[model samples]
Target: MMRRRTTLLASCTALALALGATACGGGGPVTAGGGDKALSGQTVTVAGVWSGSEQKNFQKVLEAFSEKTGAKTQFVSTGDNVSTVVGSKIEGGNAPDVVMVPQVGVLKQFAEKGWLKPLSKTTRQSVDANYANVWKTYGSVDGTLYGLYFKAAHKSTVWYSPDALAQAGVKPPTTYDQMLKAGHTVSDSGLAAFSVAGQDGWTLTDWFENIYLSQAGPEKYDALAAHRLKWTDVSVVRALTTLGKLFKDGQLIAGGQKEALNTDFPGSVEKVFGPEPEAGMVYEGDFVAGVAKDQFGRTIGQDANFFPFPAVDGGEAPVVSGGDAAVVLKDGKNQKAATRLLEYLATPEAAAVWAEAGGFLSPNKNLDLASYGDDVTRATAKSLVDAGDSVRFDMSDQAPAAFGGTKGAGEWKLLQDFLRDPSDPKATAAGLEAAAAKAYRG
Candidate 1:
């Protein structure tokens, strides 16, 4: 699923001041193509899943591009089903010039259909200079570079209120069992241990992914992602059962199961950081920090902090990451302008534009740590890069969209069902396998 967030104007204004730019606008223009207005008459259209405040921040990046190259840029939100929307546009010959694809599976699908343009040599060079080889590998199809991963997420971090944890007299956990114990302790102090975002099925998939990756290891994770191993495999059952250890406890969840099932992602975060918090912690990506700071006026490192998603059964914690890749369309009218946008996105300057805005992370090794608005975000990005080859992409995003990305269906819906009644891991596994078999066959 595509994560969507709405940031406050105050947050945007603060970021602008920090970067010496206008609110939700770019900094001073830097000339591109050896001229200030080289692409003066051109317009470029870009599409992605971002909307509201997220879209506004991305517009800042585009604004910087416009100032440099003198190209007008438009951003179209692809809504939730990005693949379907972009596919329809392509069929109707109204495809955008550029797309920020969130799913690697979708990127591969577009490449296979010959709808995507191979990135320019200049863009590839920028990627090589700024990113790690693993990022490039994900952007490539059949050994040809096709996308640049501009926005990255560290999905293994768990955000919590330090005061709440301290009230419970517990420290951040280092293992799965310890985390559960901490939850129980926090619950005893009258706050729900976790604000489960059951309404958003993607969050549940992330929970399962972290546990599965750490407990079963990367080989099984890769096999399941490719459907080489069935979802009914024992490894999946073990992971589901492990997750049930936490979800099975009603008191451990904020607002209980019913309310949690109705709560969206942002609501889940609010339960922990709001004026009168209902929960002590939330599990998701590093973006939670952005929501906490932007929406609740919480200080990231002090008021809100995170620990590595604790290791499972004494194993090393696995980093399950996700990113949005910028890909140009072959059918685009302004090919040169689109390629230049891709090149700009690959630069540290572009990454820094969003980094200072909060709730954003980049895989660009060249980006300065100071560019992040807070120490937590900088540490999160550092861990993501420090993990190097050990990091695994989000497993669901690696699967076909029908099975992984769709709402109210496939892995997403099945996980929601499991959240409602976590008693039957075997049954959930069976259902997932059935769905995967169908999606893979298609």
Candidate 2:
């Protein structure tokens, strides 16, 4: 079976299905001439929320594209709140040719405002043939394709320390009941079994989504995304109930709920390899292993390993991982070149460069695993693409802005509260449903 791994920041993909590398030389603008007419004097200004490693990789791709098309590409990296910056640019009529934002909900809004351009026939055919269902499903606003997918980072898989589990004589669980059994085994040894920075509010939603994946399956989730399913549905309630049980079972650290609300992405992994009380398992993506290695000097395969979030007994396995994608603005000045970049990004060379640089899973299925930097990342990428089973995008990321905002955070708080006492699962879920319904109305 293909081994699984998680991507960085569960919210990263939720924030867009979210992209490259190279050196550069001064060049003139190019045209879209294919054969002998090669694109020679075109320039595409890319506005993206990429900096540091993301920028480094992106430059490589831009340089490569420049080399191929003789097009001069300029990049402007935005701060984390790219939405605000992008909004102002759109209003000021200074928007770049291309911008990468997380969450399709924002893309839909842009499409509604006529900020994004419709795809050309070529771009449409390319995306249809190569991109996965997740993006195609979310990339469209109405029936038109407003976004093109490039790279993805997975979120739903659980990260753990296999060596640590073996040392504690605990096996990885295959079902919810089995997970509880393993948790008891590890807790008996006085070590943390599950570690999460629950203070982030989004973290709780990750847990909630996992439960939903196991209980309601992908059909219900798809309906949820389309706003057809009620949050108070019995299946949704069951998922919430399940999450509450896991929280109260003493499987996680004592202050997990509190810690989740306050801690950042790497905190949970640190607990697993930190100073005083090292934990054995932390549910996170492959990037968390990098954090553990950087902060605690732990190697991934040596000190930690990951597994799929187990099958739900007789139910089908839920494909869970989170990643980001690229989108071009329709009415923007550089719409043509932006669309070209989107198509270029789906190539194997670009995909490999992205995977090697940032350890991100590129959405391009044509990428060769042999080109990956390491076996772990290669394996992770393979698992993400090969997932033929049901796969749902991240919950908060898939939901509307209202559901992903304070209201959603409040719902998670309620889940935590209900986990502290499961007697009111029905009431808690109903309340959440009411909140979601109210949010949808606005």
lDDT scores in order: 0.86, 0.64
What TM-score do all the candidates reach, one by one?
0.92, 0.83
For model 1, residues 1-442, the per-residue Cα lDDT tens digits are 0110121233233323223333242232222223255678899999999997789999998988887678899999999898999999988999899999999889989999999999887677666656678898889999999999999999999999999999999999999999999999999998999999999999999999999999999888888988999999999999999998788897799977788899999999999998989999999999998889889999989999999999998678989999999999998888888987887787666788888777799997766678888888989999998898788899899888989989999999999999889999999999999999999888
Compare the candidates by lDDT and give the number of the best one.
Answer: 1
**Can you write out model 2's per-residue Cα lDDT over 287-375, one digit (the tens) per residue?**
67556655677666666677767666456656665555577775466565676677666445456556656446765554556666666
Which residue pairs show backbone clashes in model 1? none
> What count of clashes does model 1 give?
0
